[model samples]
Target chain A: MARQVAQRDDLLPVLAETFREHGYEGASLSLIATATGLGKGSLYHFFPGGKAEMVEAVLAEIEAWFEARVFAPLRQDDDPAAAIAQMFGTVTDYFRSGRRVCLVGALSLSDARDRFGQALRRYFALWVEALTEALTRVGHPPEGATALSEDIVGGIQGAVVLARALDRPETFERILVCLRERARAA
Target chain B: MARQVAQRDDLLPVLAETFREHGYEGASLSLIATATGLGKGSLYHFFPGGKAEMVEAVLAEIEAWFEARVFAPLRQDDDPAAAIAQMFGTVTDYFRSGRRVCLVGALSLSDARDRFGQALRRYFALWVEALTEALTRVGHPPEGATALSEDIVGGIQGAVVLARALDRPETFERILVCLRERARAA
Candidate 1:
């Protein structure tokens, strides 16, 4: 029983990695089973709804990880300028850690448009809202702050897409530098 | 012979629509065949390299269409601010025209990352270069203009994803308003 629990615990990261590499439609149950070294039956035992359940678990794991590593730091830093810079660094690290595209962004493109996409949209809105509030507290007007917040978030995502295509992290960094400067100026 | 040539000319828009709606990976040759009312053998005959060639043709066609309808206006108005607004309008129209995501952005997410991805990257760089040069000419420093240019482009792409998810085009308009205001301030 202990071994089974450990195996289940181990499956999340592997599944996240698989989803990152292959996307939702491309990542198959058999592929996840093989990667986790669990038989199909064991895989079914852990995720009865199959791929959908596995993806939900993956989304939860990623959301928690992002909240701790990315969003949490923003709350800790009171200086909006510094917080913005830290946010960029956190995203850079997250992307570099696994050389993965943003899972939420990737899932948004799926034809299924499952609950996974909804969860991702919610996470994005939360991040934008948090950033908007931070900028407002820093004295920028609400309109400007909200707009800038959205632009910065959007730019980071675009940079991620470019970074993946170019196989270089610097593309992401260069765009982030631009956004940081804008935030500081504000 | 004239009737056959006319038929081939009529097929391009349908083929382009298929590529736009389903994307490269999600779009199958069989579907294209059905959409175009061309048999599989006919499609193969016209596009010997199969889906890749067909997709390339579609992308090229769309690029030309954008240049004629979208980028052409930028050249018409030498006033940088006017040109930028016009550019935004063009982009808004393009997105609204078919509720389509940028094909380049969509293809970048797929496993078929080769020449197609490279082509998309080049097109994006071209856009940035044009916008940055215009901004620089309008008195903004090279660095600031380039950074802002990237932010605007990236923001628009991200907004498309949001718009699709929410089933609302207004999300795109909000992002556009922000981008235009940022440009004016810069």
Candidate 2:
């Protein structure tokens, strides 16, 4: 039982990578099994709920990483501009490290209109709310700051899409820089 | 043959709707066949290359529609703010038509890294260039205008995702209003 648990733990990262690469529908159980060196039956043994459970686990892992590496740093500061710039760095690090599509964006592409969708929605809202609170702390009106936060987050997400499409990180960096400057100006 | 051609023409919109609703990976041949009232064999009959070809056709159809509805209006006059606002209105109409995800956004979410990526890049470049040219035509510096255009486009795409997730059009409208105001202030 302990060995089985260890094996499942080892499988999670590989499964996350596969899901990130091909998305939910495109990533097959066969691919996950192959990547993890597990048979289909073993994969089922680990995740009885199958692909959905695997994806949910992957999302939770990514979300935790995002919170620790990205959101936590931003929430530590009160300077809105600095916090905004830090968030951009987090985004850059995320894409560079994972070479993966944003999980939220990926799930949004599916007919996932279920708990997965709700989780993604809540995740984004939390990010926006965190940024908005920081901005409000820095003296920007709550409404404008929230709007700005939304734009900044949105711009980064869109820029990632463009960057991946063009195979150019510079595009993403340029957009982030643009948003940072705009935030500072505001 | 003429009847077959007409039937094929009628089929494109149905296929496009399926792709738009469920995305590329989530959109299966079976679902598309059901939606279009065609059997699997009949779908294969029309689309010899199957799902990929059907997706390619949908992309083409969407590209044409986008160019007409979104891009064409921007070229009507050189007033940057007016053109940008009008472009936002086009996006509003496009999203409000009950299509939850933009084709470009949806394509980016899929493993479209090679196949449809360049086209998506070109479409975005065209959008940014149009806005940049308009802004530059109206006296903003080329660099600043280009960055602003990126923010506006990115914000709109992000706003759409948020709006769809929340099931509210107002979220998108609010973001667009902020974008327009930022453009005017710039």
DockQ leader: 2
- Report model 2's TM-score to 2 decimal places: 0.88
lDDT of 2 by residue, A1-186 (tens): 323445666777888778778877788878887788778878888889999998887777777877776666566664655776677777788777224577777676567645588778767777877777766666677658877777776667777666665566776788777777666644
Query: In candidate 1, which residue pairs get closer than 3 Å at backbone N, Cα or C atoms, i.e. clash?
Result: none
Cα deviation of B151, candidate 2, in Å:
2.1
RMSD score of candidate 1 (Å):
3.6
TM-score of chain A of 2: 0.85
Worst 10 residues of 2 chain A by lDDT: A1-10
